[model samples]
Every structure is written in C-alpha cells, then in structure tokens.
Target: MQMKKVKIDSDRCKGCQLCINVCPKGCLKLSNTVNAAGFQYAIYENESKCTSCGFCFLVCPDVAIEVSRKAKPRVEE
Candidate 1:
C-alpha cells in the first residue's frame, strides 16, 4: 500500500480554510484548538483518504501545508 502524509504548520496558518476547501480527498479540516495567532488551523484529519494530490498545498495562502507520498517497499519472492 502507498503511504501519504500531510503536514500543516499551525503557526503559519491564519484559519483561511482554503486548504480544506481545495482538498480533493477531504483529508483536511480546521482544528478546534487555536494557534498562537488565535486562529484555528487546518489539519490532516483522514489519513486513509489522502492521495497526495497537492491541491491543498497549492491553495493555501499561508503556504502552511505540505504533502508527501512514500512508495511501498518491494517484497522478495
């Protein structure tokens, strides 16, 4: 299985919700906890649904989101 990860820099986020709106997999959402800026930040909420599409990263005005994918290791026969 392929592995995908999304990292949201809470400190840099300003609760814009742009990343959440653009996420194709619905993997991102606003957190209840506010950052130091006193604004809710987007988080990778659904791990299994993420496809590393990079839409969230592209849409973020604050540039606070990062998306990554790791290929599954090969198995020897």
Candidate 2:
C-alpha cells in the first residue's frame, strides 16, 4: 500500500504556482476557492499519485507545503 500525504498552509501561501510546476507526479493544483488572505491556494489534487518526494515543499516560496510518508506496518513471523 502507498502511504503519502501533502498539506498546504493556506494562510501563508502567496498563490504562486511554482510548487505545482515542480511536482513530478502532477498531484497538485490551484483551488478556485480563495483563502482568508485572498489568495487562491494550492491543493493536493490526487492523493493516490503522491510520492512524498517533497518537491512541492522545496519549491514553495512561501514555505506552505508539507509532504509526509506514513510508516509501513511490520509483519512479524
């Protein structure tokens, strides 16, 4: 099973699409809805395609994106 998550801080995001351009999996997109700061925020569009590579987090100028991988469960014999 693939386990990955991406989160965006809407309040801090400046509506720059830099992160969206850098994502290799194309899992992110700009939302039509505006944030409290009046900026259209980035969203993780397809969680199934996320690879937790952190590319979005690195490219985000406002430092708004976060990506994490869930630890796999151990199988004991």
Runs in model 1 lying further than 4 Å from the true structure: 1-4, 72-77
Tens-place lDDT digits, model 1, residues 1-77: 55448888889999988887887778888899999989998878778887888898888888888788877799999
Clash totals for all candidate models = 0, 0
**What are the C-alpha RMSDs, in order, of all predicted structures?**
3.7, 3.3
Candidate 1 deviates by what RMSD?
3.7
The stretch of ten residues in a row with the least summed lDDT in candidate 2 is: 1-10
Instruction: Write down the lDDT of every candidate, Cα atoms only.
Output: 0.84, 0.86
Best by lDDT: 2
Poorest lDDT segment (10 consecutive residues) of candidate 1: 1-10
TM-score of each: 0.83, 0.83
